[model samples]
Target: MSNNNNFRLPYFLLLLILLSSSDFLPSVFAKSQNPITDSEIKKKKSECYADIDSGLWGGHCKSSSIAKENCALKCLSPACYELIYESDPLEEGEKDYIRGQEYKYCMYKLSVGESLEGVRGSFDY
Candidate 1:
């Protein structure tokens, strides 16, 4: 019995130590904060949903690909929204209209021909 306890004690201590250290923990069940407000979360979720980079780009939106990528990140903080809005091509009325209808739709449109093509050309870095 004493020998058994000695073996069990070592195993117990090891488990305690391993659990106390975060490195050995599983990441899948971890909690993460979005750093954005309830409003932004609601706004963005209403905007679009993208399969987070699952190691494959899958297929781009084929229409507003850039806009899809951009709005896909719309889950980011409010600061990110401000940064992105500055760059979207919708005029004031159109932007408002699109935002009202479905910001995701606007995001979809952004991944398109002349709009994306022009950006690709005009903003060549």
Candidate 2:
């Protein structure tokens, strides 16, 4: 009887260790199964922009500011919002300069009857 009791103690300790280690095993497997590649993210972003361009949100695609603002709101991820809005950390003066440049560019595009998407591609930010 004593021998059986001693054997069960080691088994219990072993079972506890296995159970505690089980939590880490799923994450290891999950990493391989749940791969979110960059291309997938880009595809989501393109789909988001397409939705915005279709005027589904009651804003015309010709209006750059409105389109950009709408796109930011509808973006799937924070990175997508950054791409559509391009509002990286900037000094106040730099922000003003970039805003002015964007306004001029949008006005020019509008004057020529170009779509906001065209201007979006022309700018780096």
lDDT of 1 by residue, 15-71 (tens): 898887776664434433333344755666545553434323244532354545544
- Per-candidate local distance difference test: 0.45, 0.52
Q: What is the overall TM-score of model 2 with all chains considered together?
A: 0.33
Which sections of candidate 1 miss by over 4 Å? 17-60, 64-125
Report how far residue 120 has shifted in candidate 1, in Å. Answer: 33
Supply candidate 1's per-residue lDDT for 33: 30
Off by over 4 Å in 2: 1-35, 60-62, 69-74, 78-125
- Which one is best on TM-score? 2
User: Tens digit of lDDT per residue, candidate 2, span 30-106?
Assistant: 33443445475567657767777776645654366555544533454443334334564222233444543443455
Q: What TM-score against the true fold does each predicted structure earn?
A: 0.24, 0.33
lDDT score, candidate 1, position 19: 82
